[model samples]
Target: MTFYDRDQELDALRTSFESPECGFYVVYGRRRVGKTALLKEFCADRPHIYFLAAQEAEARQREKFIEKIAEHFDDRVPRIGGWDEAFDYLGEKLATEQLVLVIDEFPYLVAENDSLPSYLQSFIDEQLQNTDSMLVLCGSSISTMESDVLGHESPLYGRRTGQIDLQPFSFQQAREVIGYDIEDAIRSYAVTGGTPMYLTLFDYDLPLGENIRTQMLSPTAVLYNEPEFLLQSELRNPARYMSILEAVATGHTTPNEIAGATGIDSGPLSKYLQTLRRLRLIDRAVPVTASAKQSKRSRYRVADEFLRFWFRFVEPNRSSIEEAPKVVFDGTIEPTLPDHVAPTFEDVCEEVVWEKIRRGELAPYSEVGRWWYGEHEIDIVGLAPDDDRILLAECKWTSDPVGHSVASQLREKAPHVRWGPETREEEFALFSKSGFVDGLADDLTDDWSLIDLTEVDVCLS
Candidate 1:
């Protein structure tokens, strides 16, 4: 596959690239999520210089940037020393012509020289602000970007014209990339979180479980050691980060639970959790109805599916990768992977169907989300945003057809809904990986219903 999704994002970036005068684009995301790739794709046909910054001293990185500029613009590499000199020269050289300049993993450069952003911002004010060059700053260190470059206190704050928080592929795109049903695609997405590089390993030809074993069990595989690579890159103490991730991944969502599980006190761990949440690796979510942003009952979830899979399966069992890697991987990780991903798989399905619903693909849904009464949670709830029509969908990963018993269970929970009886009427949809029960569709004829993307296609068509 030649990559998938991101069409809208690519179009947006391309439009920025061809901006009439000046433009600065900030693209940041968690590691291995394809920020660099997306930039390259966006700037493929344009006159651009793609400079990937590395972890070296400030002077050395500046020299590297100069050298790339020289190579791109001339035969001999430039002898520039400071980053300011390189930017100054580039600004001067491209003064008359439009060019795209991309600095990938820009946080590395910012880290090496604390004044780099100031220096660049000054140059932008003095030189490039009057030119047509499009400057693109890309980074995987979201926490660094937010704090150092985009933060209000930073010199570069408010300097960017457009910012792109590049995200992983969506479940629908994942299906298109390799081909799979909504349920299976969601299951895969729950594991890989729509990441293109990670999704590349999934074989459209094989079963998800088999693919996970083959692609993730091997020590040399991309995803096998993904967590370590990611943590080791952005963090000072990889061990502490690993402990924190494992605690969260193992179903300890509260600060107290994570701290207790990781052997870190809640007080100190709060800062680290905040950092992780800011970086978008983990999320602190409250029930949607809650008024408070952060409450005592708030839960933490690995917002990135790849990270969740890594923490749940890889991080906790690093020793397995060390000794008899496959034995430990297939034996322990594979066995627990399915149950761990079931709920997420359901959520992904809901998301894909929801998107379709929004585009008039799945009929007119007034609202969509997990509706609950006290403790009973509906897997999928679609409301007629305008009317009293409500859709209560139960997504089952099981092979059997959804039975009538589930309908009764839903009815019991329906009364708890604050909606008056006249305001809400229930519709049924049983999303099953193995297909709905015989007569199930016929029985739901009186109400709105759909299978996978069936309603999606009808509405869209």
Candidate 2:
């Protein structure tokens, strides 16, 4: 449960705190992504007042805020009539000393009193501009945070000196959190999806299957109802959004295909998809070589690993799970887990490629993603539009070693990717789970590279 990353974010906050002028910072991300944890870590050494807001009356919220200020500063609680008065009390303290006032879950306060932002704006403009104190507004509601506080039309716009859109951990960081081997780490990443809270829930002492059974499959488990809770909390109508997500997780990627699968009409499907995209639940993928704006062959996919796994395995088999959790995992989940982990393995391989680029082992590329056209598909493609160079890779998650035929097939599909000049430079890479055939190395040249699972671990590390 130890904090693993966010060095850059902590550094940014430290710099702002050490600055001479007052600092106004906004931090927001989806729930359980560690926004609060990061803020607490940053405030551990600083003189700060941290107040967590809840869904309550405005008066109750203000009373709690006053109590926190009083406790932090060891001063008597003041009689505040409104937010303006509350700021006046804090402003008097800021004039004498520096303080970091963080209101965690700022959206809840905004929900109760919509004019709170205006009061904070006035406080910043009129009182705290010259002080060395800081104010951090943190929230988990992405929509409310972006539209109400960070939006252009909001009264608090143009006031923030800095912002942190905290994100989930990368595959490497997730692996570090769970302390699993490369293969098991890949499987765990597929289930946890880089969410720090979920990763911390995993008992590293237990096996992966046991963890999945206890932490995810059981009806009493925390994660069993997690996806449902998140959807209900964030969206007004969770049923329709659940249906769309279920369709995408079960292989209905295109708009028409999802509409056919979910029985939601195509006209309104775009709106639902857009909302899901905004929530970071689903992603729209196009060919790596194609323009995202103009690409006709776009595909929708469940962006969250846990949600995709839940929809694919958990949601569809709730009855079976109720009957017997162990039976469901062994009979249904165990046999097909490799196939489920394959896509994540491809993603890890792509991350390895980027890591290589960072280490100067590979040249920089403009974009990297899967490439598909008609019947041809490439697992990983790196396009460097500036130098007319393309890196095409094939990732195999099978048990057997990849052979020359796989490389040959990748070569055959490379021409179908209409990128760069006909005489452009090309490179081929084959990423495998069980390494490559001994004979496959003989066919390698300066342009050909063979990467195995161990090499992937090393590259990413």
Candidate 3:
């Protein structure tokens, strides 16, 4: 759909342009995360040359690159013999004219020429550093980009002035693009997972179930093969990764559980898990009260909503879906969808509430995340910015109103958080989809914050 966020990225690029020194920037993220969109927006009014590489022969790509730059300069460029000549022409031109040269899908070019990064490094140090050129390298292959382009051992590691590991849109940004009621917008984000390209495919006019059938469940739909494509493009062995993803989506969160479910040894599984984490596909989480460095109770969860949706619902029932899309959706997908989306709703609420704290609408906090201990759990937790106080919250995604019992439960569990001194202040918040129960709102004091779906939208605004 239309552009929604990235103001920070634009500001950074604008600062780079204003600097008298040459700029070398690196931008990378998973496919369809809006990296190219950000670059295009930043380069819209500048004197720029943009070249998008493909999986083609090196000679063809070189010719295409030359053609793009030549067109931008409005001058004919002679056939370039090698990378040196191409970079030399760019460096020489910047001596007089300020320009932005963006090379998208940079990993494709590196695949074709393994020495491309080194050639680029040599050019940056020997020629471009002293000039006024702004060079931006963009890519979607996380593994290659991190290991070959930004890693410590990389030839160009020290050359980049800045690096952006772009992430998916937050709930607020996704809501802006969906253009629906606050509740429906949250659901839309939960299913589409804030990928801009996928969000465009969903029709807001249709019911959620209908949209699911048309845009995702149908065999001919664009997203039908999305999960497979994402894994195949990034990993060499898609089947193994699929198994790992399926395991995580099905509640196999711990390392031992995942290994048992996938029948893979723990040694090899760790490598695969690391790759998945680096790709931003899954996340390792621990109790909010526990130290990230010292906690041995870590668990892995699917971090992307779309991937989780696919693995949890679609992948498990693929054969049934192919045989009868409507039947499978009605019986299996629809009935279980609420429970499936509940955790995502909690995540969205957490983000919105965090924004409030940042904007001074709520009590400021130093840290926030999910908290759990033994058999007790709290959906959201915010540590006081400068003291020993903590904020605890529970997010409910059901249609039923949150009653006094929910508040009472939170009060009971507040004592178990073990954050600081026993007398530490504990503030509570209750976020609900269907609003608070009768008399429940009246019973709560000013110390409690009650947020419904509508309040979430308003607070975000």
Candidate 4:
């Protein structure tokens, strides 16, 4: 597949490569997120040696690493036995030529040899940094990479000159990859959620329903075990994490609600939730107006859209799919798929608004997120404390044209958000999937902005 986004990331790598000094770069993210693809693209035209470690014993890994280096440097170099000899040869070879040595899946190597980071740190300090070679240590294990490679207490803490914590693609990038219209693109994104690997598996020419049935719901499909495989790879106890994720996916956002749903005690649940948050699998959200430290009304949500859809729809409906695929699609998935995409649509709209703010097309809001109080809720809120300004927005995913009532309701709820003692000036923005009703624009004040699906497409473009 052709590379999509990552222009900024590629630039980062290029800058490091062109520098006068050696560079030790760290690249890490969840599995199947295109980490290897990015590194290959970066190393395509350069003199580079890429070693992808496997889940094997330490001795086997060392042999493979030596073989890769020996092949790169040719038979002129002596056969190295271990990392110490390998780094010694690498430092000597780097002095003669500019090279990039990418150790993909570095955590796998660390799992077998716990002292690999210490060896790399010494090599980098003594020899690698003295030359123009760039050492890129990449991994998919979020916890291990963060703690052992980037954490403060790790042996290689201060050795890294640059790092990139690559995330899944955004809706815009995913849309470009899917090459579909606004409606079908939204549906695809609701399921794939910006993951390039998942998006590439779907056939865009076919009906979205059929694509979902084959690519996701089928028991024999490749993606059937994707979420489980990812969880097992990154998590210590996949069952406990799966339960917590299922709880969040089923609308159990609060701690007490998740506890009730999963039957796990609050103490251990907190630890699991923190670990999941650190892995970028789930997020803890508070109201836009509430302080993070002081708010007791925080809610947990699955950060990965695909995982959310899997836990909510696929995993729960396995028996139904196994019995009859068509029946499951027509009876369960087709009917409730929109409900699954509703929250995701809101997220997409919020991202568009943030993009506008980044381009100076919107107000200078300090914070942007969803807000709610008791029974009332707002889809998007942007706060600017210094300027005493607030932006209240509503995102509607329905096909029906949104009328003035929705904007009126947003206006009604703008005052309920308590930012400070003094009243703040308010602005309104409305994002609708099917555009707005007739004459809806005439009522718009100077402070209000109306953005429909077409506008979002253009913003993404």
Worst 10 contiguous positions by lDDT, candidate 2: 172-181
For lDDT, the strongest prediction is 2
Per-residue lDDT over 66-158 for candidate 4, one digit per residue giving the tens place of the 0 to 100 score = 778778878454666788887887787788889899999999999998889988988999999789889999999888899999999899998
Which scores higher on TM-score, 2 or 3?
2
- The TM-scores of all predictions, comma-separated, are 0.87, 0.98, 0.96, 0.97
CA lDDT of each prediction against the hidden true structure: 0.73, 0.91, 0.88, 0.89
Residue pairs in collision within model 4: none
* lDDT for residue 258 in candidate 2, whole number 0-100: 98
**Model 4: residues >4 Å from true position, as ranges?**
76-81, 421-423
Residues 13-71, model 2: lDDT tens digits: 99999999899999999888999999999999899989999999999999999888878
Q: Candidate 2, 135: how far from true, in Å?
A: 0.8
Residues 191-217 of candidate 3 have per-residue lDDT tens digits of: 889888888888888887888999889
Please tell me which model should have the higher TM-score, number 1 or number 3. Answer: 3
Question: In every candidate, how many clashes are there?
Answer: 6, 0, 0, 0
| Residue ranges of candidate 1 with Cα displaced over 4 Å | 75-81, 179-184, 206-210, 292-297, 317-337, 361-367, 371-374, 382-391, 419-428, 442-445, 448-461
Candidate 4's TM-score reads: 0.97
Candidate 2: residue 376 lDDT (0-100) = 86
Rank the candidate models, highest TM-score first: 2, 4, 3, 1
